[model samples]
Target: MFKRLYCNNYRGLVNFEIELDELTLLLGRNGSGKTSVLDVMFALCRLLDGSAKVTDSSIFPERTLTRWQGRKEQTFELDVELDVEFDGSVQCVPFTYRLEVEHEEGGRKARINREILAANGQPLFRSDRGTVQLYRDDHSDGPMFLADWSASALARVQPGPDNRMLTRFADFMGRVIVCSLSPASFATEAAEESERLGRDATNFAAWYRHVLQENPGQVAELTSELRKVIVGLDQLSLVKAGLDVRALMVSFAEEGSKPYSLRLDEISDGQRALIALYALAKLTANQDCALFLDEPENCVALAEIQPWLMEIADSCGESLPQVVMCSHHPELIDYLGHENGILLSRGNGGVTRTSKLKDVSADGVLKLSELFACGWEQ
Candidate 1:
């Protein structure tokens, strides 16, 4: 689970730090940098996992630098707690990963200045410029080499018997899921199984196919939960659509009549969102995964929001290790704000700031959401 995050000079986030819990809620107005936090996490995960490089403009664009600040360097740090096995015993370890990227020539180009990974305040991997130093599980230096400054040297490290700790951290980062579901972009057809869901979940069918293959027994549990949110939902199956292609099909059971089926894309947006949300909770449970959800309540019915939130909340710390969600819905705010919410606000010059929801005092008559809606929480 992620323990804390520190970011400097990345868009509106300047010298920002936030402590995370098993479940955290990000609440604020549209431009409070709630989504920016999620974006940073997602981009960092991709960078560390070798899926993206430091120079990828889509992930880290020229605009990544804070506009008001003249600094050319951006820094990010993540602290994660994990139960790691070594020396024939399992122990909880604290790992810290830090990255610094510098912009050059008026911010048109960027390169990694420093990248470091430490465990229990001991360096396991450190890179400065093109020089790299790799350490072993016993905290002794193993190798020193020069790597590409634009890429992650840690990602390129192969798994070895003495580097289990480093490999474990890499695997954990790879499993982190960040998403803002757009039901309209979801495809009904899947060309092949996907290892992970896309950021927008456009390849949901492909990812779902992979989930079903990995956890066949969980299908029944997923269907049972889907029935609660999607009325009359009987079962979900993948049918052959074409050569090496499969399509997701949803079946509904009706009273006094034969069950009817429909393609996944044929469902309403709300229904599709509900399906994705439920699958997210069930499939990823107990899998040592971290989830970041942006506005999951979108397209979901008012009555359904709390139940889904409850489901995700209950699974945290046990089945799911960490979850960070962003939302402004009353159901979410009233239910989780006081306990788990982190309020993000823009300070002078639009630099993002963080505060606890419980710290804000409000009149007894107004709920947390009401206070926020009426600008009392501001």
Candidate 2:
């Protein structure tokens, strides 16, 4: 697993490192670099696709400034170094990924400032002039490939549990995806693995039925967990084919069936949210993959965050994927135990700090909601 991650001179962040584990959460006020952190992580995912490209995108100048916006210490530099428990022992993974923008007379493209990767804390690779390598292993026989095949390529590769695990991790990003805050319309996903319905989750019903036909026990567990988090969610029923299929679809017997649709739009907003969550939890729980969910507590009753988040962790741990989430909600912290959380924040003139919940006072939970009383409303 990736044990530590550090970044420097990237957007508002100057330099930062955080210990990491399954189920990490980034929290803080707006403009506090929370989204930037996740954006960088997602960028890494996007970067791994070999065909991806970097272009100068417009972010406000005031917003573009780092923690030391007008200070001399603020050289445009981003160095990423991480520690990973590779081969039963911890090894420092070297990273020197960086970018720089020119400000002279109508600024142009952000120069490909720097890119490098080192295994065991030593520079084995670096992008200079023009190049990138995102994935590589000191111990693997095969070369990893990501579509965005330039300067950041070595990062495209990571050590998976086995060859299969490694391949699955690199080949698919759905296992570790990010959904922007769209509490209203973010109801689904496109199926990456054929078993997966889709990100929009258009095939939720199909996938659910398939799982039931193949993995009934898991489906049952999912139903139970969903019931706990959703107030009126009664037992969910899927009609098996070769028998009964129509006039029912997947019925929430616990609630009024009320005729479901392809989009499952007939249900209450909360039900749709919970259904999406539960479906994802079930799909990802058994597999050893990772998922990055931001503001997972959205749209649900405040009281259910704890139980739902716990179920998410338990379900993910049960599956093959390791899960990490970011939230601005306190109830999430209240519900998720310390072991399940790694608190993420930016401090000290924009230095990012990552610490475990267990490290905090009294069971390691800091009552995060109250801490962000004014900053979370947006």
- Whole-model lDDT, candidate 2? 0.50
How well is each residue in 54-165 modelled by candidate 1, as lDDT tens digits?
Answer: 8786567668888878788899999999899987899899999999998886756788889999999998999999799999988899999999988788989999998888
lDDT scores of the candidates, listed in order: 0.90, 0.50
The list of candidate 1 runs beyond 4 A from truth reads 106-108
lDDT of 2 by residue, 1-378 (tens): 344545555576666665556666665555666666666555555444333344323221323445355532212322333344556776544444333322322333333344554444444444443453333355333432333322234344444553333243344433345444343553233222134333334455555555566566676777676666654455565433333342113344445556332334456566666776776677555554456666766777766666667676565535534566677677776556345666556566556666665665552343545445644312
Maximum-TM-score candidate? 1
Q: Alpha carbon lDDT of residue 76, candidate 1?
A: 96
**lDDT, candidate 1, residue 63?**
84
Give the TM-score of each candidate. 0.97, 0.62
